[model samples]
Target: MSELAEPTVDPADWTCPAPLRDQPVVVMGHGGGGALSAELIEQVFAPAYGNATLAALTDSAVLDLGGARLAFSTDSYVVRPLFFPGGGLGDLAVNGTVNDLAMSGARPAYLSAAFVLEEGVELAVVEKVARAMGAAAEAAGVVVATGDTKVVESGHGDGVYVTTSGVGLVPAGVDIRPQRARPGDVVIVSGPIGLHGVAVMSVREGLEFGVEIASDTAPLADLVAAMLAVTPDIHVLRDPTRGGLGASLNEIARASGTGVRLSERSIPVPDAVANACGFLGLDPLYVANEGRLVAFVPPSAAEEVLAAMRAHPQGSGAAVIGECVAEHPGMVVVATGLGGTRVVDLPLGEQLPRIC
Candidate 1:
């Protein structure tokens, strides 16, 4: 038996896959949902778990079951500080998943909450987070029907990490997806950019502007429903979270093989956010927004959709920021204030990490 146990392993016997070869170890960017994250999903995960549903890569999986269409989505929250200016991990967990379903033109109905708690974290903090989630679910008009809990060693886990999954019903006539974006489509943003990211960064780093910037951590399901009431033919819908508006546009462009031309001056950047980004050498375009959405509508229906968005409180500050073009397919270009055009490419990594 001792002689049979003697065996050797070859150095060339082990190697990394294409996606992991370049970076042998996972980095923060992998979770930041940028270029590296795209590679991980498209190359590694997709191939490993190949399927039509996963390949589509929409915010939610729109499935046909029992003669009805259903939208399903899941997201995890690891924002630092647990509590931020306008929200905490609990509400973010609920709102993030709800928005994902809404992106598919679905009316969210139920959610499941899962928590990973650190061993030594205060029980009061957990109670507060749970309460916040209940309030957010009520506001979003969704129910937390099921839940789970787990505990990790104190050092292994942060205070708490919340993961939420949501299910919604997609109206029969509605069909929205990034691949549906077309040339001559109008690109509209729901509200100001950079608020959620900036708000979290300010508190984490103790940096401040003259005024406080609050996180826009509200639900957008109601807003989506309102827009659908006007027209169910919206080409695309996305909440610019990790990679922000810049990344969201690039993704849609790539998926649809279209070009987007943005008016830099037309994009709404709040004064507080603008000032803070400038001081910190950051681009407001690449900053994350939790409670905002970017919609692409056909030119013929743009006006009606914009009006519908405006009528909703969540989309009060909506604006037409750009248009999809046919000239340079699969690219994003911005008309700068300097009377020049520049490419607004997807970032390689995150500028601010763990904000969402």
Candidate 2:
């Protein structure tokens, strides 16, 4: 009898990082659970998503949910121009959910996706979105334990809309929230802002600003992880998405019953995005961003957290933008670059509608 052939090992146990590069922008085929899908998950998703529960290669990640604590957050995505300059709706859905949980000082664990599709939509497009959602969840080390899909008449529903909810576990002794800000507390941004809003508007308005400007839609899990490592005593964490920094600060000020003072020079805005805002009569402060975040921390721990933020790739442009003040409680004041001051009030309505 011929000797039995050696048993073949499973691909997931190889422990080698997936090798995929030079792939063009995402397409419908990439979302299918075939070679392209595997490549996408292994290469882009697995690296940043380092966690034992997620690496199991199972349909759902089995999180030990009985840990220190849990935080739950949900958001609906109805952004027009589903496909944008730097990211599509798939990645945005994932990032938005992850950032919400991160804002609670929690490590996001599980996610649920609900899809509303317009009838006659291409199966290829739906598959692509599903694939992107799966890949995004894998990268964030979260799982889609459950999901639902509904089909609507062609004109009734937009092309597609996704609602995602996430649950996370907050480490013991972590207290990050808007109400924690004190007069001496400092404000810091994770990175450059306005990229996402400007990118989407660029595509919609068909205006090109001479150079390619893409959305900054990225997960803040790793960046938050690093910040927590340095100092878990953060005051607040928020992703300025729909309303941007102006709205976020106003919310925090009102929540904490404290006033905030910001310096225009300290905030970091890319020249291209700034120019776009100027041309369109848009204030960069109120423009949306997917990848950036704002943090409030005690004055003492501010430098440490800022250093940790700057060392990370996503927060390379991080800077301390402002500080809480005792005067003008529940308001935000901005010291302009031209030796003037202005109230950075929340816009009564959407400044750049559908930009997110």
Candidate 3:
């Protein structure tokens, strides 16, 4: 038998993949809102900008301005195809920022939009996006108070990219943050998961799963308001967007220095989404969701908060999926359907990239 040739790269290196800290060039994972994304922020951005506010790492920055608290956030959308089943770039741009601000229990009021368009893109396309943005802002009760536009050379850019920045007023006595999660906090999810990621992937990959999968891209401000109406003492609120439920839970667990216990069967994963993910060999837990939120509420307020969520249109499918625990702090464990528990760790990178 011929001896195997020496491997070109070290086999030991392949055993454990390179960490984000060792990568000199920025990879797509850096933007994925997972372990890599967190590393990028902690190792690079956070150190460079060292401040108490940035250190909080909340979805929105709560600023004390003139004795009034303001929740501010910004997000960029580069989702391919621009338009997908149920929504488009404009909708994602507006709703994303609005939800971020709302996560902090804020009443979103103003938005600033910026666009970078390719030179060859048609004006009609731009107009369509603008109209969508306008309609979304209106739906969210926010205004596009200011905006800027720029056109890049045809070959130098994607069709279009939109960035939305928003500001909202945070009510007093409301202190929602990932770090607020405690052992007894009850976890709630707004609706079915994995819809948006599957919806976008189906369109982009031109795959048919025997059933239509539409993006769950809607403004969650009103739904959040409804929940707040029940109680402002909500411990934590997170919009599971890019990294999905798994990453969001991992982030919360780490931030609060608590363990998270999830019931696999309790998570609301639509049949269509489940089938699609099964066929695509993807995990529903890590799929992106544009419109859903994960909330951590104290046990005393959990019932009322969940009821309020279910009463809202956006939260009609809300469900209590898990709770925080003291065991295995900074980790997430799920009770599997097969009567076994499994650890759900943070994703190293994005599973579905270019997805808003």
How should the candidates be ordered by lDDT, best one leading?
A: 3, 1, 2
Q: Which sections of candidate 1 miss by over 4 Å?
A: 1-20
1-356: candidate 1 lDDT, tens digit per residue = 58877455454544422244455556677777678778888888888987768867688999988989999999989999899899988879999999999999999999999999999999999999999999999999999999999999979999999999999999988999999998899999999999999999999999979898889999999999889888889989999999899989999999999999999999999999999999999999899999999999999999999999998999999999999999799999999999999999988767898977
Deviation of model 1 at 308, angstroms: 1.5
lDDT of 2 by residue, 205-275 (tens): 99999887999998898899899998888888888877688878887887688999999998989999999
- Worst ten-residue run, lDDT, model 3? 9-18
Instruction: After the best TM-score superposition of candidate 2, give how far the Cα of residue 182 lies from its true spot, in angstroms.
Output: 0.7
Q: lDDT, candidate 2, residue 3?
A: 71
Backbone Cα, N, C clashes tallied per candidate = 0, 0, 0
**lDDT at residue 301 of model 3 (Cα atoms):** 91
Best by TM-score: 3
Ranking by TM-score: 3, 1, 2
lDDT for model 1 = 0.91
**Displacement of the residue 352 alpha carbon in candidate 3, Å:** 0.6
**lDDT by candidate, in order shown:** 0.91, 0.80, 0.92
